[model samples]
Target: MRQYFPSNLKHLCSHYRSISDVCNRLKIHRGQFNRYLAGTSFPTSFNQKRICDFFGVEAHEIALPTDQFLQLISSRTPRPTLAMITAPQRAVEHLRQCSSSRLQDLVGHYHEYAYSISHQGRILCSLVSVKELDGHIVYERVEPSASRSNGSDRTSCYRYEGVAYYLGDRLFLIDYESLATSEINQTILIPSFKTRNARLNGLKMGVTACDHRVPVCSRVVWSSLGTKACGPEAFRKVREYRDDDQELDSDLKARLAKAQIIDGLFRII
Candidate 1:
């Protein structure tokens, strides 16, 4: 049971950054935790309960044979059995299945441009990659931290992972902040109608990263970079751009301008 516990604990910790990170978050002593991982010792009943609670597992479940434990946890993966899903989950899964074909053509990378949620009057350009995984359409949007000091200090990135669905002539995206897990954002875009140089115009709603976390809505433009443009060179280009930046296309700059609210509707046109 103790041997099984160590393997189960290791599996649970794989989802997190590192053992030290887990120890810090769990408020467990590093040396004692290492002993448990090494199978040289086991936690007391109280400490075992704490570990089980932190990992969202029952005490008995963690002590199961390692093979049985892995199988038990694998059942909770994204591809849950239809019988285990609730009505709402079933409906969402149905929608994803129905819309899978429509998203096949949109599986590529793009440069996402929108008004800076943190910095007024500047446009924030981020890298977005959309792909089909396990019969579902998913996307990842990466934005460089606003506090990057002239590239002197390391630039940490904010990543948002979301699902994409094309429904009723509109493209819809809903994502949460993957790093901090503090916020969710939604974007609705009009699908491209033109054959050449198509840009998806949309509106994004998200809260600012500031202390106040004020909710904001801004016009967003996504320009396709094709499938091969999401590597290092593209990521380096992700950051807020001044209105007068020479590299920004004049048309794109105009499209991202602050438009007036007309009759209670914030129009992107």
Candidate 2:
């Protein structure tokens, strides 16, 4: 038990930045902490509880053999099921299981509009299809073209296909670029279907540049196009809206102005 105790203690301490950091967090003297590490002594019951609480583990950790301890802890962890392997699939599945049935309302086609975070103030627009297939909701976005700044009447087209799901009140769309440009996008949608606001609003974050690339991750606002349109009309709208030569959905415009990115609500990977 003594042999196992010191080895296990060292293993746990190694997780921390340093033995001194762990000792400081434990509020124990450094000398005493080192003695416990050397297997020459052990923590008091009270101190053991403090250590366990700090690490968010049980007090019996010290008695556990290093291997058995790791196995036991790992066994308690929630493992991902097959469906959760992809962010798109996971988002779609989570939305279905979430307490609210509002996810069903989002099933349909929408034209997504947002300003490019990487390109400064330029608008990025695309058409999307969201629907349930078999047992999950899938998201497909098609960006027909990137508008030319010089009004050259020519544009670059692309498509993104992926799965989408919602957590709590927020919806997530994870997509991949068709070419090997290594692009992945995460578009967040907030449900604003109530109170005459038919369009949903959220932020789109992902890789913006391919070669000389902008910052690693860029952020942009995405809102739904109010009414559905056929190919020619939709494509025209996507371009005109880019240069502010066209009108935006009234609800979408209102939502964007009111929305502010909450720093505490976001985290960097």
Candidate 3:
């Protein structure tokens, strides 16, 4: 797979001091850092995390195989049944049609548990938390690495958590949610991005499981005008509507419908 470490090294230089300085702070060998910059070597999960933390970047941003490599690997891996790939793609397409504002809002709220699939076929999903500060949102994802010379890597993913989020900045995966929750304080913020909705839809489409529900104060939906206003019966109605479907529960259906409406409105406006 094509390596992402070189560009990540450039990103590090923009954010930190010389490679030697970064190595010292990460406690990795300077030579290793040089190799990383040259794309001749990759940091173990531990170092990848450390460098990411040091530069305040996501672990996946630095660790995920480059596009060329991912494509190559995916091609080599046996293709899933045609049904498997198409379903997720359709669901993602439905999500993309959502309002930019609501999408931005949802991402800000549940930035942690949100997953984004790009047009380029890259998938970034989160199992972490969202932090809101000074009107800005921060999403973080942490992955464990096998121990290496730099001690284990400690990089994490950070984003705003919505369809509108930048692909490069917002995509990620956490190696272990329990470990991340224990290490950091995870708080649920405002449920604006219909992240709850996306989660629900993901379940319905079989892209994810129904059990992956995130707690929300209430559910909201989009009006015909494509404005994101609160709906009193929307959540309940969603529940009632989905109650009949064998694959989804009333609660999940409600969440998914809310997300779809919001996402649809996002696209309309």
Candidate 4:
């Protein structure tokens, strides 16, 4: 019944500057918007109302078969536009435009370290790779964990795909957990200005994977592993480690410690 929804939604979005613009207007995550565009999932009734209200169409009308839906909106006026795009949107666009030129130096593999959300008191290391794609910087992160479930060694992997932006001397990365699709993570790191890329430290904000799903914030460190280590061998290294694990050096371990407020300001040193 909703087969036409994807195509109709695409048609509506084509009138905007970009799908990003449409998602911004609808207050939807870009990753979730893509699922609707690809027909892999349907928007909930609440989202349907938001979409319908934004496009001046009825819910039933949007579900019409493509040909009829096209004809229905044929005489519709041009897509609406604000007197000026919001300042935040303009800033985002500017950052996206700047990412391609500014992030080449950081396009490589990294070992991402953070306090484990699933296994408290352990440090988790995930494999991450960043690269330039179509004038935009995109990255993929893979988390591989091994545990004994039902008396058997089972490995569970979680993957995330996200975009990176360098704006105002800081690197911003936002991604949704692709495997679960229930979490969106944001990391803000200090960009490396040195001639050589080095360990970059930042804060990560996201909900835990536990059943309770408590929101947690933790300090994270990205250690450059260069371009060659992003293959299968790299993934082998993605797992949790004890605090005394030799792989986690003293300096790196120090950086990932949970932060505390000092003088009314939270700091990750």
Candidate 5:
């Protein structure tokens, strides 16, 4: 079946500074690229995916109205200005500004309150640090939890390292398990910067209750541990918080179960 590059796709290709450059990157023949640019015909499914990936756009974007496509792409893939790829030191500073967005301005330690995947109404407590050094923003996380499911007793620790940045209104940390599975964790932290218990809420891509795995949404939340520099002494506070523990502050429990940010036992500023 013959198809054509929709108006939106053509517009997206036009926005690029050079058609030849786009063709070279996409590895599409110059004639073929021009055909698509003219909206005379579309590429094969594989080529469509390549083109969309090259543009950092969704495949469905080809069918979207120009305005909607523009809006969607604008938010997800902000136009890379010449300022970002410039060779001079000032240009480098301009690029750094995006990674060091307003949210990343709060870089330090936090009492990560991740919702447990194995048990219901329980929380996993850990320590995480977000730091920006030499214009590179990065985060380190350490989660310690015990699996008591199936009457088994085994303890495990999950450590992750990844890049942290703010996109739109939320802060995101994209990390992978280095020593273990290559599973990618997309953690979205909704910050109420001055709110008492402000922390990054989390979501693991897949829910695995001990060997049993399912594609379900597991609840996760984060609470700021504090911004103070830490040492070996600070590591003692992490624990598994079940709903009934007396040590678990009521406000914190509410925040974990109900996703509320309050200022009681812990506060972030």
Candidate 6:
């Protein structure tokens, strides 16, 4: 479907000099906002909401299909596909006990908790130093083409430090870096293994224009497994296996089970 932003936004504030004006108000850069105006890029749902707040407009108005078209550029580059990891049998058995509804609830809760931690404006603008204790896993911040429209499209600018690890059934983010450490205290969602490839090659993570801005990392887990872990509802579904009363359909249950099992073996070293 085609997408667009409201035309009236340009005419609203007389003092607004350029897309830069809007971005400055929004705390984003001029070029990034220009991409949105030109229809060469599309903002993620989170950014779309931020843009709406900046312009004093509704989210729907700022994300009109035609606006997306204006910034649309056709690229024929082929993206990399994520590698499939094997899940543990024990994890599958554990997930089989829960219903779909319960699983949804688990994912939802996790998402809300994570969002609350990240939305507090704590992690923005900081120099983070990264270190891998276990292995040669290098985590570098990159600016992906997908984030070009978000008004902070600078490439690999911010130096945020954090260690990424794989838990039993999820990915965890711990802030050990000096930058924004006091403000950000807790494990946040970096990305799930299922969606790691999309985040790395397609959506781009760890890159932000401003010093204190929260990096825009696409929740690729949702796109990869056809489910989201960014909200309470989705979290419940992923964790539903812990429930005993209801049962999900075989296919969905299998996927969740697999995700859980895979999460156990891949320790981010």
Best by TM-score: 1
**For model 1, the run of ten residues with the poorest summed lDDT:** 76-85
Candidate 2 residues 112-178, lDDT tens each? 7666544565666677777777666776777745454335577666778777665677776789987
Model 4 misses residue 101 by how many Å? 3.0
Task: Give all candidates' CA lDDT scores.
Answer: 0.83, 0.64, 0.37, 0.82, 0.64, 0.34
Stretches off by above 4 angstroms in model 5 are 1-23, 26-100, 147-156, 193-205, 259-269
TM-score of each: 0.66, 0.53, 0.24, 0.62, 0.54, 0.22
Number of backbone collisions per candidate, in order? 0, 2, 17, 0, 2, 46
Winner on lDDT (1 vs 6):
1
Residues 1-269 of candidate 6 have per-residue lDDT tens digits of 32335343344333366655567556666776666666677666777776655444556544445434234312223332111112453343234333122122122111111011133321121111223433312232211221221334343332334434444444444333244443332333334345332221111133243557564442212222222323334322322122122443343223222321245542222
Judging by TM-score, tell me the better candidate of 3 and 5: 5
Give the Cα error of residue 12 in candidate 6, in Å.
4.5
RMSD of 6: 22.5
Considering summed lDDT, which 10 consecutive residues are worst modelled in model 3?
Answer: 114-123
Better of 1 and 6 by TM-score: 1
Residue ranges of candidate 6 with Cα displaced over 4 Å: 6-9, 12-15, 63-269
* Candidate 4 stretches greater than 4 Å from native: 1-92, 98-100, 146-153, 229-232
Provide the global lDDT of candidate 4 against the true structure. 0.82
Inter-residue clash pairs, candidate 4: none
| Higher-ranked by lDDT: 1 or 5 | 1
